[model samples]
Target: MSDRAETSERTTMAPRASELGDFLRARRAALRPEDVGLTPYGERRRVPGLRREELCLLAGVSVTHYTRLEQGRGTRVSREVLTAIARALRLDEDEISHLMDLAAPARRPAQPRPEHAGDSARQLINAMAQVPALILDRRNDVLAWNGLGHALLGGHLDPGDPDLPAHRPNLTRMLFLEEHMRDLYGEHWPEEATLAVASLRLTAGRNPDDRRLAELVGRLAVQSGEFAERWARHPVRTCTSGTKRMDHPVVGRLELAFETLQIPKSPGQRLIAYSAAPGSPSERALRDLLPQGRPDAEERPRAVLSAVASRG
Candidate 1:
């Protein structure tokens, strides 16, 4: 597929008010009155969980106002009001951001897509070859990766076609939908899922109009019940640095530290590098699994150029 076509298919679309309302209602419905310290009365209520009035009471907002907000009638919600709702709903930082995003969307005509890495960013990734490094766009599309970078993560996929949405191996989708991902990560699926959802939640809040991102969220919501459930809870988080244990097919059980460096030129793009302490079993495993020769010089230059170009 052409670059634009691939991008359009993979990126999330903007969220509509109705979509936002339904999401809110679903989440609200999942909570019981007692969850928020509200008394349950009128047991014959038609709804399965807390009623709008009960939610409002717990949230310390008027029933009518909360209802209007849930019904997509209320606009211009104050930050304090949003925080109250978040607390009542037992939302995390991620979910709170989502609520705010739904309440106040970014003005149409998104800020210009940031410039991709310049030569400097390329050098950075290249210099860290021993450390598995890859660059990803705002929507989490894999923009570029060094050879070792490819082997460490998605060596099975066509790295050249990383930009194509269909071919794009979204970290979340792979975690839940791809059998290889389950096999590769073994029991770390839950941790991976939480991080992915949290990251997506953060992105949604920052760039709600991103059509491709919206589509991704919608697709995952439909395909994976677990994803849908967590997404509705509106959890948000940023994954900058973390420790991950991976059961690699070739490298065996490997525990590594990872750091995400945001490319200065690319507003939403980040370069992630994975490392293991020297002489550790995981580090030795990685070295043994990776090719022994000096890294291919030809592809290095192209990878650097691609990383920079993707920002544009």
Candidate 2:
């Protein structure tokens, strides 16, 4: 609640309009004239890529309108115009979705916070105790994590506290800025960085009005040059299932397969469970560490889930 007071004083911050413009422009420039079926002009152009008129012709928008949009002068672009621009630039679904978010109108006002997790969510986490399980909000906050979860992923934090975001141990920030994280994961930082940036990109597409999420990303970009580089590449990926390698101080090397399960009716919350193959050293180590076939359960207050209609 005290944290809420601090957060409330800094609410309603809007995303940077120039940043959005730069993003759109960069994506447009990446497309070659030949790739889009346009003939290369005879002379070298001053700009690195496509001219504004060329993109407008490809996207079927007026030169003035497209120029205005790219310059961040237009604020009321319709979905039709956005779709046209996306098609002209040959954007995939994810890129198109990001474009839509960039073009969306600003949110009106703050609404009540949504329910973070329910009894069912808690039960699911309890059931997966033998497996490292964590519940995260869209911004990658550690909302609720079981004992094995904390032990396996981040041993520095307490699993019993839901307000851990105050310490700001975001997975993205840890992977990039924290030396402990680099030592813990070592060679796997690239994989982890890709997934973290990809997840953040997906969340941005889904919740453009989430000011806290925006702030967290801005901070990460400023603090970590690696993150800024990866983000600039415009790499997008979905994290549904993957294999993660970790060097746990207590358990040594672990090759664990992870599955991300979306919480039913919880739009942005996901339960990530990690498990090693049976009879493997990692699995055996996990079982040996767990006592008498009992899994550890730590209870804490859930996150504040906003009441936005589910867009999933």
User: Per-residue lDDT for 1-312 in model 1, tens only?
Assistant: 543443333334423454456557867888887777777775587886777777777778988877777776776678898888888878766677677777784466455333333456667776776778877888777766666777777878765545444465567777777878778777887878888887887787677666566777767776776776666555568789989888887778989899998776767788888999988999998886675674573365466456746965
**Residue 133 accuracy (lDDT) in model 1:** 82
Best by lDDT: 1
Q: Judge candidate 1 against the unseen true structure and give its global Cα lDDT, from 0 to 1.
A: 0.71
Best by TM-score: 2
lDDT of 2 at 253: 85
Query: Relative to the true structure, how large is the alpha-carbon lDDT of every model?
Result: 0.71, 0.70
- lDDT tens per residue, model 2, 1-312: 443332322222434354457667878778888988999889978886678888889888999887777777886888998889889888888778777776777664344353345567767776776888888777777667666777776777655445433553567777888887887787887878887897787677567667677667767666676776666665555778989887777767888899988886788788888899988998987765453433335333332222122332
Ten residues in sequence with the least summed lDDT for candidate 1: 6-15
Off by over 4 Å in 2: 1-19, 109-116, 163-165, 232-234, 279-282, 288-296, 299-312
